[model samples]
Target: MKNLLYILVLGLFIYSCSSTKNRDFNKKEITANANDTVRIANDSLEYEIIVIEPGFNLFINSIAKPRGYHSQSYLENKNIFLVQEYNSRVNQPFNYNPNLYIQAINYDNFVDYGYEVNYMLYNYFVFFSREYNQRFSVPTRI
Candidate 1:
């Protein structure tokens, strides 16, 4: 009985130690991913966009087109269309997956958010669509 008790305690201790190591590794990974954010702030206009989705930074760097590939007007047009569709989905949770369309994006056509803002927004929409397997009414150009 004494030997069995010792073996059981030892096994529990080893199991706990291994689980703690895995938890520590996961914490470090989450911390690293927390830095993966895309932020664009227009202080003059008081307009800002912060994307906290994981893998977006990597997507933009590796998969997305280089900056200036699309003209500002082109980006704006694409963003406008995509935003409308996205917001529509957000509005109708019953129709669309609530998990996928969590919040509506406020995008005004009248506001000139500059090339960089539009560019990032457009790429973000593209990334979101691809990541979630959500398709827009109009086909998204890669």
Candidate 2:
């Protein structure tokens, strides 16, 4: 009983002392204007993107399919890497607010592996931009 009381008090103390700087993700906007454009330069990918009218559709009706649902063990650590990579590579957090037509992706449970998922996401953004002519800029990074 005494230990439990101590633990509860310690927990409250730590919680109260923790910094709140990163807690308000609500301040960030997930949606962008059709005309909004961003330049991305990162180790995973480099590209320029225009937000484009009507936004984007993430899932293309191709024969290819996403990896089946993932188990928690397989997702460990890789989830953090994927989020970090996704956040870094996307001009905005597609993980947070996917573009216009893009479907809500199950980022946590969707992939069999990390690299493939990132590759697919980066290309899909490019594909959406090119196919729609909604976004244009140039050069290349792969």
Best by lDDT: 1
lDDT scores in order: 0.88, 0.44
Q: By summed lDDT, which 10 consecutive residues of candidate 2 come out lowest?
A: 46-55
Clashing pairs in 1: none
Give residue 61's lDDT in candidate 2 (0 to 100).
31
Estimate the lDDT of model 1.
0.88
How do the predictions measure up, each by TM-score?
Answer: 0.80, 0.23
Error of 2 at 19 (Å): 74
Q: Which ten residues in a row have the lowest lDDT in candidate 1?
A: 19-28
